[model samples]
Target: MALHFTDVEAALDHLLARLPAGLRVAAPLGLGKPHRLLNALYARVEADPSRPLHLYTALSLDPPSPGKGLQARFLGPFLARHFGEDFPRLAYVQAMKRDALPAHIEVEEFYLQSGALLDSAQTQRRYASLNYTHVAAALAARQVHLITQKVAREPGGDRLSFSCNTDLTADTVDAHLARGLPRPLLVAEIDPQLPWLGGSAVAPDGFFDVVIDPPGPHPSLFGLPRQPVGDADYAIGLYASTLVRDGGTLQIGIGALADALCHALVLRHTDNARYRQVLAALDPDLESHPAVRDSGGLGPFEVGLYGCSEMINEGFKRLVETGVIRRKVVDDAALMRRLADGTANLGDHARLERDGEYLHGAFYLGSPDFYAWLRDLPEVQCRAIGMRRIGEVNQLYGGDEGLERLQRRDARFFNSCMMATALGAAVSDALEDGRVVSGVGGQYNFVAMAHALPDARSVLMLRSTREAHGRSESNVRWNYGHATIPRHLRDLYVDEYGIADLRHASDEDCVVAMAGIADARWQAGLLDAAKAARKLRGDFAAPPRWQHNTPQRLGQSLAPFRRDGTLPDYPLGSDFTAVEQRLVRALAWLQASTATTSGKLRIAWQALTATPGRDDEALRRMDLHAGAGAGTWFQARLLGLALARTARDH
Candidate 1:
């Protein structure tokens, strides 16, 4: 039987007494962290320098703390409302931010929350670059002997569930046991709010060594707010959606682009005529593209799709609710093969219901509404979403390759990247100067799996341009120093303009295809570089048809749908109120305008001469009043101008 305690400090005292010095601990990433117990342990180690502690984890959750400024005035109240005042933050992350960590302690993570730790030199130095599947083995190699996680159980039940995270804990324990080493100490912190899931997420009562059952009113689970989608995102999503065949498998990551893709898929299923109309406006010849002809279509999904992704966010929930992700896959290989070949009869319906799952994921993190949906699911609906191990979800070489291949037929792995070279290399995780923007999570595994599978393709989405210092820079470069996915594994690439099918294509052909999707201003320069390198003919020039790849063209094509309410900014719902949503747009505009000297001067001049009172509601939301101070007066005026600009553009 597990040793259960109700007080976190008492549990910490017991752990310190039982474990050895120089303790090495591993915890689950994202929402599965046992915050109370970990915070207690961290406090103990921080107070006594003689006791050393090392923590290994990824994606530490922290509530938004917008510093003192106009931004803070706007976001302070909203953060309190969304994340709750009692949301548990990782103590180590706060210490690292202030450079207050003790010399004897160390914190290492395989992945950082995207762009969260970019300026923390201490964190960047200790960052571990490992794929999601390889994290367990890496932790085992480091002799991680203690595992702590948050778990869920019935009101008075004995069984435990890993809840939102079944990604690495099981694999870590198994890796140590397989090496003939002693099993690591397992600790669980019970949280009533976590949903109890079955399948591989269940654990027996005796599986844990210590269980902390805190009193009522537990801390809130971390929730990621939904991002607004833009014209470029919708255009990219529209092109990517055309490449999904009916009854195919889908894999997507999180962010605005992924949400946009989900919206496009839902549109394709529900209002296919309007979907096609929008697609035609974006790209008239998209249907004739070879990639679309060979592996994609432009019709409603009669058989629906099966989702197999590493992370299940709100997009997947929306897809499931809309019946766009209803293709069920069973665990038995023979049954799956029979069903695929139409040899199985309706008599097997009972067996299918017992073993079928429409979606398989390793972990999940999304908004609070998504959590409630999971918590309130009916038993049968809950069973259909099987949470498995990271190894099974990310790779094909797991123990049951044959069954996985059958389940993942016609797979289209869609992911996002920051930049791509003209010769087909992707820069997703890091900058050229070796600064880690984000660690490589699972992009490489899916790309490799797409190559191993016979009928699968990996599609990498990129925005054609990004704003840097108030000027537009092409994301498709002629050459780059860093690469996450190299040219040898080059596959399909998509942007707002179109798709570039580079699988098995020549270097020259790859350059031309990449140029076709690049911003029109940079296409000629890209081709010129290829010609100078002797990779293309001296007479080569970009086709006249590609010259219209501009943001104006994309916005014009999608503006009508946006006006008619067919396409929306927050299709998946937002936590921000109506006034706050307007503020978000205006703040984004202000940030972009302040990125350069000339733009800053222009904005300052406009603010000095701007008329006020038109944005009183927005000003009141941000708590900005007249004559508070010179800074406040200037901020109020600048914000009013930004609001006016965004409103006019809308």
Candidate 2:
């Protein structure tokens, strides 16, 4: 029987009394972290400098800090509304940000919340570079003293569920046991809001040494507001969608691009004529591309798809609701093989029901709506989604390689990258200067697995261009210093332009394919570099079709669909209201405009000439009023111009 407590301080006292002085604690990443308990522990350690503390984790969830000026004013109310006003933030994270950690205290992570700790030198220095599947082993190696996470249970139920995270807890505990190490103290904080899940997510009896079921009024789960998808995102998504084979497997990362891809997949299944129209508008000859012709299709999914991903984001949920993610995979290898070969009897519904699952994911973090959907799912429907361990979801050698291979047939592992080289290296996780943007979680595993599997391909998606210092720079380059996925493992690369099939292609062919997908402005320079390096033919000229790969052209192609609701900005539902959505666009425009000196001057000029004409609602939402101050007036005018510009462009 686990010791139960109603107060976090009592649990802290118990931990302090039992654990050693040099406390090494492990917490689950993302939504699974027990913030209240962790906060209390951190407070205790901070107050007592004699006790050294070491915290190991990844993707520590921190609510967005409302910064100064217009951005802060706009976000403050929204943050409080979305994440409760009393939401518990990790004290160690704040201490690290302020560079005020005690001399003996340290915080290390496998993955930093995407660029959150970029400027925090302490965090960057203590960062651990490990794959998602390797985190458990790393924890065991560190000989962590405690493993604590928030868990779920039904009202007055004895059983516990790992809920949003089944990523590493069991694996870490098992790894420790296998290594003949002492069993780490297991602690669980019961949060009523967490959805009760089954499969590998259910914990065995007496799994925890301590359980803290605090009194009511629990804080809301941190919800990631849906990002607005741009024209480039839709173009990239449409191209990527064509590469999905019917009845294939999908593994997508999270973000606007992933959402766009899911939206495109839904459209492909529901309104395929519009899908083809948008594809044609993007590239008239897209269907004839070898990657599409050989490995992809531009048709509705008759057999649907099975999802196997590390992060079960909101996109997967939408895909499921749209009937695009209905292909069920059973755990039995023999059954899977028989089903694949049409040898198994279709009439045996009982066995199928016992073993079938439409999706297998390690963890989930998404909007509140997604959580509710999972919480309210019928038992039968809930069983269709299996929350497994990261090792099982990310790799092939875990439990049953044969079963995994059968289940992941025609797999397309889709992930986003920051940049890629013309020769086919991907820069996904870090910068050239050895600064980690986000640690390599599972991109490499999925990419390598794609190669190990006979009929699978890893699709690395990136926008063709990004705005840096208010100027468009090509993401496809001739060379880059760092690579998360090197050229040797190069596979499918997708941009707004098209997909580059570099699987087994030679240097020259890879150059051509990569250049075909580069922005039109940068294509010539990339090819010139390739030619100078003697990697490409000097006589080869850029294709005429590739020259039209520009944002203007992409916007023109997708504008009609965006108007007709075929391609929505928030394809998944949004927490942001209509006015807030408009403000988000305007604020994005303002940020981009202020990125360069010339752009800043232009914005200043616009502010001087512009008037805050009939946008009272947007102004009131931001709390900007007439005659507040010069700074306020200038901000109002600048925002007015931005709103007008975005509106006109749309």
Candidate 3:
């Protein structure tokens, strides 16, 4: 029998009364975060101010607002206005930023919500960057003292499902039991609406110490902020799409670039003609790029891919619905080997393996639409998309590497990073001075897994340059103080301009390839730096084959038809209406221009000096006019600037 309480306050009173001070609470990351319980605990600590409560979590959502400046001002309002309002303020974020919590409350995070956005020194000092594969190592070392999770009520049964957070939960429980540690206090907040993911999410009735189903929706559901795709991102995604061979394993991360890559893959699999057109517009000489020429293809997958991601995001759901993510992976090592060797097929495989899943993910966080999709899925289809322990999905050294290799053969762990050296060393987390941007989540594990697998490779993606603190900085540089994926584990690197296949290339070639993909303005400095370090020939110059490697040239060649609206912000398509798209584009331009010193002035100059003209279609679509209202002034200004750029281009 289990004690159930409708009042969270009463439940907390009963639970905390029994537990001593210095309670160690471990919760799930992302969507699985139990905000209500955490808030209650924080409130209790706030009242007492002496209880030493410890928190262990990763990639938990922070408040929408972080950092300071024009970009923050602009992006903050834009986000609050649309897309994300259901997300609530985080107790962890508040404590990290302002010291709002008790002094004894220590937060040890495996990953952060958005590390790059973090500017708090205290938050940086509090972070612990752990490899996703070795999370259990940290757990074992720390001796997990307590565990609480958000779970879904079982259908027609008195039980709970681990639901959205099976990633760390199952494995944590298994590892905890194996270590023979004293059984910690276990509790669950039951949300009946949460999907009952049957594979490993199912749990017996007596799993928790107590259950609470409070009557109102006090803890808002966490949702991932939807990132809009852009031209550079689309081009980068197009290049990456070509590298994903038919019937290979894919491991894509989250964010705009990942979404763009997903869109490009969809186009390749469903609409190859348009994909080629966009590719030609983005990389005219892709055929000249040797790595791409040797391994890349512009064709659709005759046999589709199997997703093996630590985070199964909204993109994977879309891929699954489109039939692009269709390869089933079995749990048994022998079955996987047979399937890999082509001796057994999904249709005729042993009946026992029928329960084999199409994708294996650690956890997920996406939009409200994505959660709705998950909630509405039938039981059988729900089983097709399974969640597993992070220890299993994140590492290659553990159990069934053979089966993992069979399932994730030709694995391409496509991930994003902040910076990398020309030699392929990467910095996915933290800055040179140890300011934590985002904690190293699973990129390290996937990179090592790729290196260990015979046919696997890691594909690292980033914009060649990113605007930070109002300055454009090169993401591909000669060297950096920190590295998430060191030079030894280097593989493929992609930017908007092109792909740098550095897997087996020499040091000099690595420099050349990195320079090839760098933003044209940053290339000379990078090459010069590499030479200063004696990594490249003293008199090195881009070979004759690299003559057309400037941004201006790339702009004209790779995306020649961008102005004609052939390459809209949403290249594949979007749910946003035409009016919304137009508005979003204008906002994007304004935001980018305002972020830097020269941007607003540049836009003003273009609006003044360039030919005064009209884009009636755009104005009509966005419902803005020359003399509507005060609201129209902003739109009108943006339209004029866009038109000015168009006049100059023509």
Candidate 4:
């Protein structure tokens, strides 16, 4: 039987007693990192300066900054003012932001919940750029002497289940045990709120050395709500969604881009005519890429996709509910074949046997609403989503190759990258000079999986440019030193402009292809750099058709659809009311305008002209009845922001 503790300090004291100095503690990435245990461990390590605590994990969430300057300033106050007490202020956020973390506490991140802000420098220096599949191997080499994870009890028994994160823990233990390594210290923090999922859920009494059942619910800080998908993100999503085959397996990353893709896909499945309308707007030559033209069509799913996503978010849930994400794949070969042949029936679970799970996820953290939905699900219903070790889900080449093949047939591991070299290499986390913004999560694993599965393809989405400090910086560059996915593994790359089909393309062609998709403003600089470096001839020019890849063109194309409300910032749907939706539209337009000098001037001029009482469309765009409840606050703020911008411009 495991020793039970009333408090974190005492529990960790017992845990520390079993371990040596210079401890390497491993845990599941994301929400699975037991915050209480970590706080206690941090305090314990703080007291002892000689022993350095090496911590390894991935996708660690930090306190989200609303954004830069005016956006963060105005939006932060607005959210707090509107939501009031309902707004979340997570304490774990400070762990990444502040300097309370001791120097001896070495944090090694495998991934980051990226949103332009990278808080810690010490953690960045200790970053490990390993594929998700190799995370276990790396841990084992260090003789990972300790493991602590969050788990849920079986209502009454000592048997526990690793609820949110089965990703790294089980596989690490299994690998260690198979190699005859001494069992690491296992500590399980029992939280009642964690949903008990099946498939490798059960753990015997002997598995854990200590169990700490906390008094309160594990604090689930709502994940950064989906970012607003503006014209750029929508355009990217529109093109990227075209690459998704109806019958294929889908893997997506988090944030606005994923949400945008989900919206586009839902449109494709439920309303193809509307989907085609928006996609055609993105590229007049929608048939340019044969794959997007043929395999990717505007139609409902005849063969619904199976999801082997490493991380499941609100988008996945929505997809599931809409029946857009229904095809199930387990380890069984026959079931995989059935799924491929459009004969697989999930209702017949007995006949449609599973070797592992239908959907293998590591850890999940979404909005509070998303979590509430997850918590309310029945055990049988939850069976469809099986949380597995990160090692297994991240890498498909290991262990059962045949089984993985069947489970991940037609796999499209769609992920985001910070930048990509014109020659087709990708940069996900860090910059070229070595400032780590985020750690390389499962991007390499998915890229590898895409390669391992002959039918699969890695669809990496690189937004053309991200506004940083009010300047648009291109995500496509001449070359980047730090590569998340090397040029060799290059597959399909997409940006707001269009798709770059670089697979099997020559270096010169890769340059042309990448340039074609990059933001038009930045493409010249990229090409100039390439020419200076002798990679391209001085006379070389972007393909004639590619010259149409301009933001102005994209905006013009999307103009008509904006009025019909087809290309919305939140395409799937919005929980916000009509009034709130208008506010969202206006606020987003205001924030986005900061990216361009001309845009700022135009918005400033418009704000200057609009008087408060009159029914200005700009005012109406924010809200119709501007003096009611939250709308009252929005009206004041909107006017104040306009005034502020006008004065600032002067």
Model 4 over residues 134-170: C-alpha lDDT tens digits? 7887888778888988887776565788877777787
Instruction: Tell me the tens digit of each residue's lDDT in model 3 across 1-650.
Output: 66888887898888788787767778888777667778888878866656888888887776466334323433454455444565556676687777555577778887876653377666666677788767765665677766778888777876688888877765676677788876667778887656667766676557787888877654445666566776667777888888887778889998888988888888788878877887776656665676565655678878788888888888898788887888777778877766666786655475434676888887777766677788888766788887777877888766777777778877778999988899999988878987788878899888888888877778899888887867778888888999888898888998887898888788998998899878767778988988988889988887654555555665765455566654456543454555445555665566666576787778766655665567676555444555566546654665656644434242
Q: Give the Å shift of residue 161 in candidate 2.
A: 0.3
**Candidate 1, 1-650: lDDT as tens digits:** 89999999998889889888889999998999998888889988998888899999998978778777778987899888888888878899998777678888899988888888888888888889999999988988888879999999864677899888899888999998877777889999999999888877887548899989999788778889888899999989889998898989999999988998999999999999999889888878889999999999999889999999999999999999899998899888988898878888785666886768989999999999999999988988899998989999999996699999999999999999999999999999999988788789999999999999988999999899999877999999999999999999999999999999999999999999999999999998999999999999898877898878998878898889988877898989998998898999899999998899988999999999977447778888888855487898888889899898888334
What is candidate 2's lDDT per residue for 1-650, written digit by digit as tens? 99999999998999899999999999999999999998898888887878999999999989888898889978999999999888988888898888888888999999988988888889988999998999999999999999999999865678899988999999999999989999999999999999999877888889999999999889999899889999999888999999999999999999989999999999999999989999988888889988899888999999999999999999999999999998898888888888888888865445776668989999999999999999998888899999999999999996999999999999999999999999999999999998999989999999999999988999999998888767888899999989999999999999888899999899999999999889899999999999999999889999798878888888888889998888888999899998999889899989988998988898899789766465788888988855477899887888788888777434
- The TM-score obtained by model 4 is 0.84
Q: For every model in order, what is the number of clashing pairs?
A: 0, 0, 4, 4
**lDDT values, one for every candidate:** 0.90, 0.91, 0.74, 0.72
**Top-lDDT candidate index:** 2
Candidate closer to the true structure by lDDT (higher is better), 1 or 4? 1
Clashing pairs in 4: 166-388, 167-389, 167-390, 168-390
Query: What are the clashing pairs of model 1?
Result: none
TM-score quality measure for candidate 2: 0.98
Please give the lDDT score at residue 486 for candidate 4. 92
